[model samples]
Target: MTSVVEHDTSDQFSPATSPAPEATSEPAGRDGDGRAARSRVPALRTFLATAALVACAAAGGTYVVTQRLADAAFVSLEDAVLTADALPVGSTGAGVVTEVLVTEQARVAAGQELARVRLAEDPAQATRGPRTETLKAPMPGTVSRIDIAVGGVAGAGEPIITMYDHTELSFEAKATEEQLRDLRLGMAARVTGPGLGRPVSATLDHVKPRVGADPLLDAPLTEEQKVAHERLTVVLVPGTGDVDAVSALVPGLRYTAEVDTRTAVGRIPAVNSAG
Candidate 1:
């Protein structure tokens, strides 16, 4: 009777067996690779952003450099020609020129005798002899032209010789109104041309009051054209140097002038000192 009752006691008393846990479904290395690729996306984005920033900075730097260079002063070269101040020498009294002492292109000093004029003898007073007078150069210069020849009669105060002062040598240049704005008195200049053994030094001296078309033009022009062609005349005097050397450059010789526009700015200090 006890054996029959013990039938299902083992099933009730034995420890219950838990069902085995289900296996997780996943691909090999897929999760790690996906995590790695996702992490690298942020780094790649950061690198691209940094490169853009650098490119922007370089472009900005280049623009700033170009602006500075554009503001710097520049040397300007202009066409010019050598010229001089002229002085006329004339006879003080009316008479016939008997002897000519100086010829054209000859250099003379102040008060130097240039010619001798003999006054006509008075017929009413036969006893009076012809009065001889000497003509003298008014200033030191070179004879540029001769008006009267030997034995030619000249009137009183008539200019017989045209002379150019050796000390008044200058260079004349023509420029537009805009170009003249950059020039000023006392600015340094360098001149060069044919037969000029070396570059000559000069200084800006004068700016003429009149502004008009070139006086040497041969053709006529309309008013509008003339206004367009108007230019200012600039005069430059010789700088400190040998006077004879400067005088060697004759008038009407073509030359070029390099004008320094740095007078207002870009001047070097007299000395560079550190305290």
Candidate 2:
């Protein structure tokens, strides 16, 4: 037994060897494919982000252009004045004013006595007393101006008072012929002034051709006169809203008017022709 153990001693003294581990190719390949897919995700996200930014920029540009076009379609006139129906009170015969029954800014009705006048005594007819006459308003209106005082001599056809119909309110403006071409009846408008707390809605009533030269010009004619001479008188009436506010405005008050040409563009043939 001792001799048999000695025979395997040299083999036992050598190093012991174990089997090698197997390579995991399948898991490595799967991990490589997953990494490739993850790398593509960032590129796809970047592409989508770029596309969205471009769309937003395009939409903004379109809105700006549309706004500019809308603004360009409108026309504005700054030289506008409020006006009303005016009637002048005049004497028929030469006389002296004896008494003034109506005061300034007094509301009166038709046939209401405003003043009394005494005719000059005739030297030829000594027995006749001074002929007295009473002056009455021809129409219903407010007394705007009183030109004669008590005991003041008034000639025939001389104006003693001026009355205005406040109910008939209108806005008058002057525009060049070229500008008038773009305007039409029934077009929407907005009137603004220092007296008006907010813009008053209005509509175009008339566009009349001005006769003779331009009344607004005081200086000599220049190159500007040629184009400005043929002006159109534009009249605008209050809309369906509170017209009382517009009527309260004093005549001759300055205001700015903005005409909405958008609706008039297609509805009115003249506007299209001008364009």
TM-score of each: 0.61, 0.70
Candidate 2 per-residue lDDT, tens place, 1-275, comes to 45554466655565553444787799999999999999999999999999999999999999999999887777787778888877878778889999999998788999999998898777887699789888999888888888899989998878888889877888988776667777777788899997898999988777655455455566666667655565556788888684878766678888999888765554543323322
Q: Score residue 185 of candidate 2 by CA lDDT.
A: 71
Alpha-carbon RMSD to native, per candidate? 13.2, 5.3
After superposition, candidate 1 runs with Cα above 4 Å error: 1-79, 120-127, 211-229, 264-275
Which predicted model would earn the best TM-score? 2
Candidate number of the best lDDT? 2
Q: What are the per-residue Cα lDDT tens digits for candidate 1 across 171-270?
A: 8887666666566666787788887788888877766665454653868888867754566567777777845677865788878887777663433221
Sliding window of 10 residues with minimal summed lDDT for model 2: 266-275
- Among residues 3 or more apart in sequence or in different chains, the pairs in candidate 2 whose N, CA or C atoms overlap within 3 Å are none
Q: Count the backbone clashes (under 3 Å) in each candidate.
A: 0, 0
lDDT of 1 at 268: 28
| Candidate 1 similarity to native, TM-score | 0.61
Q: What lDDT does candidate 1 reach at residue 128?
A: 77
